[model samples]
Target: MKKQNQKAWFFVLPVLLLVAFNALIPMMTVVNYSVQETFGNNLFFWEGLGWFEKLLRSERFHAALGRQFMFTGMILAIEVPLGVIIALSMPRSGFWVPVCLVLMALPMLIPWNVVGAMWNIFTLPDIGLLGYLMNHVLGIDYNMTQDPFAAWATIIVMDVWHWTSLVVLLSYAGLVSIPEAYYQAARIDGASNWSVFRHIQLPKMKQVLTIAILLRFMDSFNIYTEPFVLTGGGPGNATTLLSIDLVKIALGQFDLGPAAAMSLIYFVITLFVSWLFYTLMTKDDE
Candidate 1:
């Protein structure tokens, strides 16, 4: 018993130490900053929960938070069902499977900054293929920089194009893992394609769907790069997301106290919603 316990500690200790060094320390520092105010020249004062109270009352924070939630909600609604449909349509076996998988994975391999930059260039009104086609070929006034709705649409479309592949890949993995016997049984019972998918594939893919939704939600909620690069949160704060606003406060205006407080609130909101998602998703599993 003593030997087993010692071996278990040996395996777990490294990971625990790594977590402490990497995550815990940085988190503690943020927590400390969130509750304090600092002036230049190394002066610090304990403000307690003053920052938090101010954040809760700030209309700017409220607007940004609402917009962030709207973006996240739209992303999940669009990506989840679309990914499921695409996954279900993909061939289970054949020469095309690897080809499809590789193609799907390609977008995910690109660096995030590159993805943002690419979209930024690709949406240029005069030079970009999409911009040219939309403006000239379709005979429509479509410039994301000028139109708020256009900017929002472009951002949503860009995100879907970039990240939908993640959901596709995860759902595909779940679909493949489903035993062949289940399909065979469904076929013997004369189940239609819809019935097979509804009764069999959907149920089997639940866990992966949960994981994919959670990942996409958190990522989209905290999204800062693509939209930032594409829009600069510009056209007069038309796309000023919480992250963009947070950065504006932290670095642009150099308000560390308020920024730290906002960041702490951001972290708390993410944690709470993530917990809510996990509970709802896995409640049925239990």
Candidate 2:
């Protein structure tokens, strides 16, 4: 048997060290703050688990977390199916293939903050295009700044517009990689379009779909900038997701200890749910 080469380890060591330096240092700092209270001037008092206990009992935390779950769930429900459908409709070959791909990728290429700013301007009631059309032309009472439902709808639609492209691109990649033989066999068997999709295309796309679900789940769960810029967590706390709430506690209220504790809890919940998603999605492979 040939010996394993060890030289490649040296090449990767610097990157590993850099990652650890960045991640571990901040994590350790958070851990310290989580268990301690600060009264400024770098003075910290031992608080033990007080902050965590307080956070678990806070109604604000519960509401924010609930909103976060709602947002993520809605995002997944809308984007996943919509993306798959768009991907299936895309041209599989020739000149239109590149054109379709470039269009699909355009939304994702825009900066996150810019997307939020663009939507904010685009939805202004009197002057914005969508708002003017909805309120004036279509005669709909639509104002995100004054209405909770409108705010939520605007954010959800904004997110779908911004991110469904990711799911579409991933799904399209999976679709394109499927062997042409599968389609030919389905045709020979007189498979209906629905039957072809359900039986062959869906099964073949499982791996990429798993990836899409996980990525969307994590991103939506942790989303901050767009909603913050678009709604500022709403006309009220109607759209305040967990990340926004955490930032409010940390910076808005200057509550370092509770913020740190909440961050740790948020981190744990994300990890646990992600693990659950991975396990359920891949269980059949085992």
Candidate 3:
């Protein structure tokens, strides 16, 4: 029998330690906070799962969660298909390949907070480009700050603009990675475009699309910075996502116990749903 090298762990030790220090430690802190009540002077008392129970029953929590799911669902529905379409439209190989990729990548390159701020300014009623185009040029009463529908539409559109490129890039990678022989064979078999895509391209892209879906789901689900900056959970709680609500409880109301519980719950929901997605996507493979 060949002996495995035990020395490989030495190279990976630092990374493990780093993860523990950064992720594990903070997680432990959150876990601690979730079960305890804290006042001032770093004092804490045992509260058990009271906060969790309270939040579970709270109508406010339910509304925030529902809104969050709705937003996430909307973006996923829009970004995935739109991304695939855009990716399919892109040149397979040419001088425009790099140019197209660069353009697609521009939105993602901007920081999240900056993206939110940019969109907020871009959609402002008075001096903003989009707002001006809609109100003045198009003669539409499109004010996101005051209109709930407008606010929702703006956030959804902003997210789609920012993140759909990610899906496009991933899908393109999957598409380009497919063996040229597959296309040639499909052509020889007199395969239709729809048939070629349905069988050859889609099956090949499954892994990447699965990855894309998982990434988009998690990111959209946990999203805070952009929408918070763009909407501030307002037009009066019209778009208060789960993360925003958690922040409000933790920071605004100084309700540490409830906030901590909500965060843990939030974490579990994200983990479970991501796991569920992965499992469902990969089940046939297994």
Candidate 4:
């Protein structure tokens, strides 16, 4: 039997310490707060799992979670297919490839809050470009501030604009990684474009697609800053996602115990859904 080198653990010690300080410590603190009620000057009282029970039965929590899921679902439905199509349409090898990649990357490079702020201004009915196009140039009633549907649509479009590039870039990478031999074989067999894509490209892209879906799911589910800045969960709670609700509980209402409980529940839901996505995507292989 070969003896594994224990010295490698020393090399990883710094990362472990960093994780403990950043993640583990905060998580432990939240766990403590979840079970304990707090008052002024760091005073605390035992609350047990009462907060958790309260949140579990809260209508507000249920509504926020439903909205979050709907937003994420719409994002996935729109962004994934749109991204794959964009990637597929892109040149496989050419001077335009880098330019396309750069353009796709531009939205993602913008700061999250900045993206929100930019959209907020850009959707102003009087002066903004999109708002002008919709309201004046197209003769449409496009007020996100007043209409719940409009507000939801605006946030969805804003998120898709901001993050679809991630899926495009990932799918593009998967597309470009295909060997020339596969194409040659397909050509030799007189395979149709759809056939080639269905048989060759689809399988090749599955791994990356899985990654894209998981990433988008997690990020969209946990999203806060952008939507908050853009809509403030507004048009009468039309876009108030679970994260925003969590923030309201934690900071707005100063209900630390319930907030902490809600945080843990949110964390678990995200983890569970992400795991389910990964498992279902990969199950076919095994």
Candidate 2: stretches off by over 4 Å: 1-16
Expressed as tens digits, the lDDT of each residue in 54-155 for candidate 3 is 999999999999999999999999999999999999999989999999999999999999999999999988799999999999999999999999999999
184-280 per-residue lDDT for model 4 (tens digits): 9999999999999999999999999999999999999999999999889998888899999999989999999999999999999999999999999
The C-alpha RMSD in Å for every predicted model, in order, reads 2.5, 2.8, 2.6, 2.2
Residue range 114-194, candidate 2, lDDT tens digits: 999999999999999999999999999999999999999999999999999999999999999999999999999999999
Off by over 4 Å in 4: 1-13
Off by over 4 Å in 3: 1-16
Tell me how far the alpha carbon of residue 101 in candidate 1 is from the true structure, in angstroms, after superposition. Answer: 0.4
Cα-based lDDT at residue 165, candidate 3: 99
Where does candidate 1 clash, by residue pair? none
TM-score of 4: 0.95
Deviation from native of the Cα of residue 143 in model 2, angstroms: 0.6
What lDDT does each candidate get?
A: 0.90, 0.96, 0.96, 0.95
Better of 1 and 3 by lDDT: 3
Q: How many clashing residue pairs are found in candidate 2?
A: 0
Off by over 4 Å in 1: 1-16
Model 1, 1-286: lDDT tens digits are: 4445457778898999999999998888878878889788978899999999999999999989998998889999999999999998899999999999999999888887788789878878789888888888887888989898989898899889889999999999999999999999999999999999999999999999999999999999999988898898876788889999999998998878899899889999999999999999899776
